[model samples]
Target: MLEVIGLSSAAQTLYAALVERSPATLAELGHDTATAARLEELGLVTRLPGDPPRYVAVSPELALDVLIQARTQQLTEARHRIAQLAARFHRSAPEQDSANLVEVVMGRQAVSRRFERLQREARRQVRVFDAPPYATGAAGNAVEFELLARGVEYRVLYDRRAVEAPGTLATIIGYLGAGEQARVGEVPVKLVLSDHPMAILPLRHDEHAVESALVVHDSTLLGALSELFEMYWERAAPLHVRRGRLAEATGAAEARRDLLPLLAAGLSDTAIAAHLGWSDRTVRRHVRAMMTRLDAQTRFQAGYQVVMRGWLAEP
Candidate 1:
């Protein structure tokens, strides 16, 4: 069976019309007039000067040549357009990657991109969830420094498990010393989550699992995740003075309100440490320091006194 292919039904009809009336105008040809008219416009037919637009198909030899030329021009234009797009896509790759995704990433370089996203998005407030004590590498640390220099507020929730990593402990302490919000607690999972452009890291410490990351930019998703972080922050113990205060609560204190609600939530020290990339020991140390500073006997008491005196809001 010799199967004819390529030309659409309308195109075949138009071509048949042209063959029947070799020198007929569009009005005279009348076969698939719409298709024929389009072909005529593409210069497959010759339109002579007359009262109305009159069309006649060029010789077969000439018409095929014109069609081939038209197709070649179309392909050439498409290639050029693709090249331009590729150049622009590479230029905007970093910023654009931050706006999408929710999954795990393997390899150091792939992880680097997530860090870049956090640095770029750490604007007003940066809340972290389930991270390592030394979750961020040197490049990541530098980015955090840049964020601090830019006056971007930050909050971290760390898992107690990360305390095992001494390097992570030092990193968290350094960030605290630099005046960023950091806390330690027990988390259900080990991951790093952000607000606007969020990223997550696994807590297992296994370098092979690529299923340990997540990134999201959708407003609803991020908001819900932020609420989760807040919920955890409430129950988690305070490792340092939050919102700039003396870590005490007496009467008519002048500090701004701290994240007391977060501390009130059920997040444990280990979970808290994981979320913010801090160690459990660091979390405990900060809490102990705060307790001593506030003259409170227990965690609840310390939190209560601070809230009562409103010292959490102090500068």
Candidate 2:
């Protein structure tokens, strides 16, 4: 673990020994002078002037924190440099070779890292085609919230099937509450577009884990993906949070108001029930009441009525 911060194995072992038995002579710690010197340079150990100089291990809470902070700064700088290089490469690669526009990233961790970097580097917006067979769990996407808080616009188009997946509706609702412009529709592919330059799409659609993906740079393919997102976004129904007068109400009224977006998104009754933590029968009752109040005979009609009345307005 200490190697991550540029500590040699010998130095790490020496530091561990000193920590376990502090204020010990170098010989007593079973490490040579060079290892102790290295640890001292890293501020992990201190040497006292005595007949035979003894070393004291610095408290890990303080010493390791300093090392960790330094390492984090170095990594951040490295990432910035890599981003610069990537931008330059993307600008020049197309003229040199058209095939260079799309890079293949292999392995789940690489794909996940690429996806995160793309989002982190976005200056304006992130457009996503969210569907099933995800490379990663939706719950682990804390980065999206961070970006949203930073005023980065997020436009996410959730597939109907993705919305109906177990525990996914609640997650989508959280994103909606966080100022994400969300919609539900038939997504033709799984894609993530950052600004207008870069996009990523999975290479495999099997039931197995995602093993590979294509990272598309500024190219015709990327422009087409951006257009594809806009096309679906226009056709998809916008998902909104329960707000205004309905949000102030309690019981069935508020529940029915909350149900409008889900219904419009074409989510099943079971999906809505799971998200609201209500029984299926109760969900059905509220749906029927809402339909009757709207004077609509079907769920689709009820959804249209709510949108037309502007009942599900954003705060």
Candidate 3:
């Protein structure tokens, strides 16, 4: 938060200490006097004059108001400038298309067409949540290999189920080795994000079937989707499973390793399934299996067994 307001790390640390401790003197605070003075200049701290002078921490409510206003003003100006640049760079569009930010593309074929078009039109990055609900049965996606050849960055996150998805492993492996950064997690709702300030999220939030899709333009919703993808991306481990060779089992050990912490964190069956991109029934099945493995009669006992086995990695 301090960094958002352009405060240095040292300045933030000192300001926090001052706010919490209410240091009567800079010397007592035991921080660089220059940093305190900088904070004072930023209206984060106030120096009260006295025989024994003191530095007072300003109320964050007041200080942050000033910062927020400044940032808002700057963002407004930036929007104006971006609008101007966009006007110059972009061709005039159809009135109907321009009027609507969210365009609903119906049917699987239309969605696939949009995917290809978005990829080609994108200037820099392409983000995709690859999972079920295939529009085409060609064993690959709408994105072309020419994209990477031309230096377009691809950040694709696959559902754990999708990584083991039939006829898709070799394609995923090619993408992973060909400079496309990939990771796997349980992600529902298939969508594509292009560099052109828009995203394609499913009309249905809970399912992967692409009967329809919402093309989200530059809006708060688009920003939130980007953030959501980032949150999933951060939690998702990079795919390290060896290429080729379909194992007899889907490999529960690794999957269990990933599932334990979320279980420990007390996420519900449905919530865990949503994050891991598995079904609720599948999650319950796994829990039952885990309970049986540990010879536990209850979820509580299974949890205890997981902890006892150092599954939580407690030191």
Candidate 4:
């Protein structure tokens, strides 16, 4: 909460303590005049108007507003200054400087920070190739939805396993419902690109810690990455998240329903099994059952039945 309000660690510690143990004098709290004075100035701690005045914590609603406004104003001013400096810097930047085109960022925190910053600063679009192993959580998903709400087009390409993991299909369904375009297929690398100019990719494909990341600016490499994204997007099958009974259902029925589009798109059963996180035998079994249900003799007939039955349409 203090982080959200932009308070220093020391201030947060003192404020939390006061809120927990209020109506106590500074001395009783084992604090001297200096610390108390600072907290008072920040409107985190208040004093009762009586003999030997006691310090108390201000209401969180009022104090948080004060802190948030202060930080917001400071951010507004800083952004103004940064805009001016950026204009000057970009004006002097060398367009042909190959040495400065790519920057390496080290450590997990720094990589995560840069990734989130790129998403937050995206102007028109954000393209992401999501794969495992991933340490990020629902917060990242929430932020993406928020950005989508603000008219930033999100094109997300997820690895087959990433979508097949338990509980992920529903999340993808929600994303599709919110106007996000998604595809599921095998991808070589995890990537994040904002508006086609800036990109963040792992330093090594197999490393799990995100120990290093490469930030790519506008360059030939960026173009290659963009083309690579387009290539996968083209070959990838469209993802339609089913709702109602399909949404409430899981297991074989759910997986079979998801498999229809790939079948319609002419993907082999092996590829469909890989995407659906099932074995070849399981896929074949489901396909045979589906063919029987439709009284069809071939996969093509079953796929035609899918379209005719409206199984591929949005709910």
Best by the TM-score measure: 2
- Cα error of candidate 3 at position 66, Å: 49
* Whole-model lDDT, model 3: 0.73
Alpha-carbon lDDT of model 4: 0.76
Error of 2 at 84 (Å): 27
lDDT of 2 by residue, 135-180 (tens): 6765557889999999999999999988877777667767878888
Question: What is the C-alpha local distance difference test score of candidate 2?
Answer: 0.83
Candidate 3 stretches with Cα past 4 Å from truth are 1-99, 205-208, 240-315
- The digit string of per-residue lDDT tens for model 1 on 57-88 reads 66766766666667778889999999999999
Worst 10 residues of 2 by lDDT: 241-250
| lDDT top scorer | 2
State every prediction's TM-score relative to the real structure. 0.43, 0.63, 0.47, 0.55
Q: Comparing 1 and 4 by TM-score, which wins? A: 4
Error of 3 at 122 (Å): 1.4
Query: What C-alpha RMSD separates each model from the true structure?
Result: 14.1, 15.4, 21.0, 16.3
lDDT of 3 by residue, 1-315 (tens): 668877999999888888897747877877877898889888899888875568888998999789888988999999999999888666555454466878989988898787778888889999888887666556575365779888999998887566554446457657766667776665756878887977987787545567778888887788888988888876554543233321222568755755664454444676556556678898898878877888999766676576567665531
| Order by TM-score, highest first | 2, 4, 3, 1
For model 1, give the 10-residue run with minimal summed lDDT.
250-259
Clashes of 2: 0
User: Model 2 clash pairs?
Assistant: none
